[model samples]
Structures are given as C-alpha cells and as structure tokens.
Target: MSQTVYQQHAYRSNQVPPQKPRPEKTLAQRLLSAGQRMLPWSRPTQTVSTRTAQVSPSQWQKMKTIAPNQECFWNEQTLEGLTGNIWARVYLIFSGLGKFVILYFTPIFIVTLLLTSLVTTGRFGLSDWIEALWAYFLYAIFPASIIWGQFEMYNRSYWKPKLLRKLLDAQKKFELNRRTGMVTLYKRGGKVRYSYPFVEFDCILATTPSQQGLVNYSLLLAHRYSGSMHGVPLGVLVTPHETVAEYYRLWNMIQCYMDVTQPLPDILLLEEARPKDPTTAAYDQQTGRNPRYWRDMSDDAYAEAITQIEAKQSKMSETGPEIDIFAKAS
Candidate 1:
C-alpha cells in the first residue's frame, strides 16, 4: 500500500509556456508597403510651362510674329483692362454729353417759344387763355421731350468702342474653350462649329446712329471674331482694318440671319471697303506714299509665311530637308 502511494505522486510539471500572439497589421499599413515598392518604377510627370525662354533679338522678333493667341491669358487680360477702361471712359463721356445735350435743348426750346410768342404779338397777356395754353404746352413738351431725348441719346451712345471691349472681355472669359483654342459661335441641334484660328470682325462700326440692336450685335461679333479688344472704334466711325479682319469668320456668320422672314437682325458684320475718294487723301511727299492694300495679305497668311521662312532657314542650316524657298511663300 505504501509503495503504490509513492508511485502515484509522479506528474508532468515541465511543459513549455504558451507563446504571445503577434499583432495583425491594418489595411493602411499594407497599402503603404505596396506603394513603397512601386513608387521608384513610376514615370515622372512632364509639365508644360507657359513661360517661354528669354530669346535673342532675332528670336524675339520671330516670336512676335507668332501672334501669341488667347493662350496667354495675360494678353487678353491686358487687352481687357486697357480696352474696358478706355471704353468705360468713352461711354461715360458720351453719356454725360448726351445728358447735357438734353438739358441744353430744353432751355433753348423754351426761349424759342418765348421769342415766337413775343414776335407774334407785342402785347403781354395776363389773361387766362394765354396762361392755360402755356401750361398745356409745358405739360405736353415735358414728358414727350424726355421720352424722345432719352431714346435719341441711348441710340447714339449705345455702340461706343468700350461696348465692343466689354463684349470681348466677356467672350475671352466665357466663350472660348481654352484647351482646344476654339471659339463657339452658335449651337443648333447639339452641334457646334468654331471659327478657324482667330476670327475677323470686318466693318463692325459701319452702322449709323440709329441701328440699335444691330450695332450692339456687330460690336459683340467683333470681339467674338478677334478675342481681343485692340481695334474697336471709340465712336460710330469706322474701325481699323486690323481689328475687322481679326474677326472675319464671325463677320461672315451674319449671313445666317439674312433671310427675309427672319427676326429683325440685331447685328450685321459689314464687308464694304470704304470708297476711295481723292478728296480725303493725305499724301506723303517724301516717298510719294500711299496706303497699302492690306486685304491682299492677311494676318494668318503673313504668320504662316514667316513660320515657313523660319523653318526653311533652320532646315538649311542643319543640313536637313531641302526646302523649295518659293514653295513656302504662299
């Protein structure tokens, strides 16, 4: 019994302790590791900077010929500020003049009436009949003259050069597609076509004093054509050819409204060249000079010719393609 009790006391107390569990990683940690492995293999992004290099005299002259489009937002911005302010000043001056014109005519007309009454009858009437007639004329002339003067002033002052600048500034910011460099003119049936390169304006200010909506429309189309406000006229007088031709495509667009049954045309891009009158000619005796026909060589054509000339010069200097010097002229 004693031997059996001693043998029963044996036990396995040397077993190993349980190991501590490792912490699991989160999704963020896994991603970070994966990113680290792939980053060195990825290609670096190539950014195209707008700041062109400081060019040489010849290169600078050449760059000017490129006609730096509306791509440089600053070009249009400069134009907007300059043109907008100029237009604002012009409009304000004309508006003030218009107001003064109204104020001046009223007194003048009253004086004319007094002179007429005095000339017709030498007697000064303190009678009720004279007083009633005078009151009636005053009442009738006040409202009617105001209405007429307002209409005339508005019609005369509406189409100043600043209006064109305002329109152009708006178009540059709102209408142009900066990526494609295309200007949207009109949209129909979900389809759109733009002017080729820069638009030309033609004779926007050709209108007389009474062409209200038509004049405004022409001014709008002028900016839509050029995307810049450089050549718009200060008054209803003729615009510079440089400004008009810049927006020629948009000028041609006025044809869409030429139909007889169409709505009253608000805008018309005129193409009529000013008649050559010997009476208006101012000559230069030094060179016996006359104004050149700008219509013969367009801005676009001139730009292309310059580009071609440069390309050929570059090619010849580098021993590359043999350019027919004459072929590039056109």
Candidate 2:
C-alpha cells in the first residue's frame, strides 16, 4: 500500500505498515498502461477499490472469505487461472474410467473370444454353438465400440485439451500476466483471442440468492466497456459476513495483485513468492515484517489470529481503505 492507503488503515486500526519505494516500470509498460487509461469507461469516481491493508492474516486466505482462491497459483510474474474443481474432476473421472474399461474389460473379452473360438473346433463347436458365439459377440459390441472410439479420439479432440485447460486452472480460459499488465483470453485450443490491459476490466460484485433464503457474493472481472464477452469469474465468497466489505476486499486483493507498483498481497499462499518480488522484498525489509509470519506460526496461534481478524472484521468500515486503483487513468 502507498502512504495514503496506509494512513487510512492506520486511522481505523492499530497496525501501521511502512511505505516502500514503488516498483519502476519499463517505458513500454508505462505507455501501455497510459493507453489503457485513455479508454472511456475505465474510471468512474476514479475507481476507488477498497483494500485490506494488512501483511499477515489475509482476508481471503486466513478467513474463508472466498472459495477456491483465485490467487492459488500466483507469483511475482503471473497468477495462474483458477476455477471450480468441477471440470478438473470431470476430466479425471472420465479419463480414468475410459482407461479402466479399455485395459481390463478389453483383455477379458479378447481372451474369452480366443477360448470360445477354440471351442468352435470341438463338438460344442458346430452350427448352433457358432451362432451362440456370434450372439455373444453382438452383445459385446457396444463396449467394444466405445473402446475403439477411445483409441480413435483420445488426446486428439473432445477431452484431452480440456484436461490441459483444467491443468492450467484455466477452465475459464483467461490468463493474467502481471509483468505485461495484460489479461489474455484464450480460444478453445489455447489460441489467444484477445489481450487487454488489466485496467480495462471492471471488478464487479454479484449477489446470488439461494432457495434456503441465503445470499452469496462473488466477483467478476468484466470488460469496462465491451459486451461481446461475459468476462472472467474472479471467485466466490464462501464465508458469510455481516457486511459487504469482504467482497470489496476480495476485489482489492486482485487489484493489488495486478498493480505492479504495489507488492503481492500478503497471504499465506503467496508468502514464499514475496521475496521473489523486488518491491515486496523491499517493503518487507523496510517494515521489518517476519518473512514467515504466517508459515511459522503455531496452529493454536493461527487460531487466535483468526479470532482477532474476525473481531476486527466486525468493526471494519462497510468498505475497506478506499484507494483509487485507476488513479493513473486521468
């Protein structure tokens, strides 16, 4: 966070993080960022994104504020895509089942055919027995056909590429590159359909109602002005909150991620990657923040930390520290 963002947090909370030098961007990056800002609908109210100004006990990581964390595979350079486990599980289940049927049932049927073919040469072999074997073969065709299809179509179409997609955690087909400041959407076969600056996306909060009279919140990173696309599924909030601030906090964390000027959002998952980011390492050095603050802590200490964060959540503003994410978009 910048000094202003920290000041806002310090006023309401006890912790005051020291400000560090902002990371320098290359001339090309500067020009690209500037071009993205010139886009019309990119900024309204200067796009103040409320951010949680903490290093440890990240709102999304420590608290169950979101599910299947969007930044599960993030780094100093890029954040690998994350989506629900449904598709990955789908790939695993179908692939495993197809392999089992082909290897196990296939050999059993082949051996049975060989044994039965030998029987045809014997007294049990003649006319009626041959007809019976043919009938059995007919009965086996459906599964045999499937096995043939698996051999014919395997890894060429349908499921193999989808498996690759889930392996990249890209069920949604988008890649966020922090170094390039670009969000690239992929076509079915990993083709780059389009690339836009991260600022071109508008972080939207969606409200969903369930049959049990409960409401759920999720985030979307939709294009600021385009309607051709439905945008990316940021992630869903699983933990219930007394207010909507937690959703905003989730958005803030994402903004913190893509904004190279700032450090990686301090979370347990990203702890190891912090030292890899020059800006983050510098910030940690200046603030004297423990490198393994969350990692080395005892499980009981973590539980107590969680209790403290929850207590603070009750007192947090309806929105967190309001800082203009699109401040450069003038």
lDDT of each: 0.31, 0.54
RMSD (Å) per prediction:
30.5, 12.9
Show the lowest summed lDDT stretch of 10 residues, model 2: 37-46
What pairs collide in candidate 2? none
Clashes of each: 11, 0
For model 1, the run of ten residues with the poorest summed lDDT? 38-47
Q: If scored against the real structure, what TM-score would every candidate get?
A: 0.22, 0.51
Best by lDDT: 2
lDDT by residue (118-183, candidate 1, tens digit) is 876956454634675577457655555665454444334433355444433323322332122223
Stretches of model 2 off by over 4 angstroms after superposition: 1-72, 84-172, 187-189, 237-243, 318-330
Best-fitting candidate, measured by TM-score? 2
